[model samples]
Target: MGPDDAFWEDGEWVSWDEIHQQIQYKEWRAKWPNADLSLVPVFEDLISVAEDYFLATGRHLQVYGDIGELYAAITYGIRLHKNFAQGSDGRLGNDHIEVKTIAPMNTKDQTSVKLSGHFNKLLVVNISEEFEISSRMIDRASLPKTSGNILKIRWDDLA
Candidate 1:
């Protein structure tokens, strides 16, 4: 195998979303034939600007949550509900899904999300310090019962 193949097989990945601006509308159409990807440019621009600002100032913009939601929708073929929709974020087939994103700048290392709404399944996403994104999906029934609504999805969940 080549060096690039070895790099990928070793469980390291580079973010392909870095080429967001380079894709054509037709390419997006081919990628998601059932979904409209017209807003890709806007999302790409927002991410680019945020990353640039963070690099220059070393402070994260409060945009990672939104990024995570968008990433989930596109990556997992979920149809999103309108913003501020109570209960859950979107639908995947017949399942109501909620998404939680862990930011790269979270120094505490521990992260938990408050599940205040109704969802059949949960998608926990994390952006590593290196900016590689990963996710874990859990059935609502599999999650541990907590007194509060908090779901403590540790970093190892992504591993």
Candidate 2:
């Protein structure tokens, strides 16, 4: 098992979109302590706009990055830092976490990590076209040392 097996459950993933749909006719889980339920509607709006835009034109909007980041924050109880924050994106409890978001439309099922980023852990969030989200959270110590501005991690490796 990987270093994150205990927390991530062998890369087991959950679909917030599916859950949201189930409660569409009702109320959202406002008390999800770690998550900002308000952002849910905004994210959904973005999704709807993207879908509409795609249908209108043959182009895509690449909005999944934010969606992916938000997933990591909510799932792992990370409190995100302000915009343009250097190094890590947020903190999970007392540990800093670097979040890498994988866009579904990408030709490859992988993500780019910043070598210069600071964090105690690395959280990679992958979002499917259906908005089904999944993630791989690994302790920083588990990552191999490399020299470069960026590093790549494939979904296969995480799984």
**lDDT (CA) for every model shown?**
0.74, 0.74
Residue 144 in model 2: shift from native, Å?
3.1
Please list the Cα RMSD from the true structure of every candidate, rounded to 1 decimal place.
11.4, 13.9
Question: Against the hidden reference, what TM-scores do the models get?
Answer: 0.72, 0.72
In model 2, the clashing pairs are none
Lowest lDDT block of 10, candidate 2 = 1-10
- Give residue 124's error in model 2 in angstroms: 1.1
Q: Put down candidate 1 lDDT per residue, 41-137, tens digits, no spaces.
A: 5556766777888889998889988877777776677788999999988999999999888888977544676677889898887877766677788
Model 2 over residues 15-51: C-alpha lDDT tens digits? 5554466685245454345566656677667767766
What is the TM-score (0 to 1) of candidate 2? 0.72
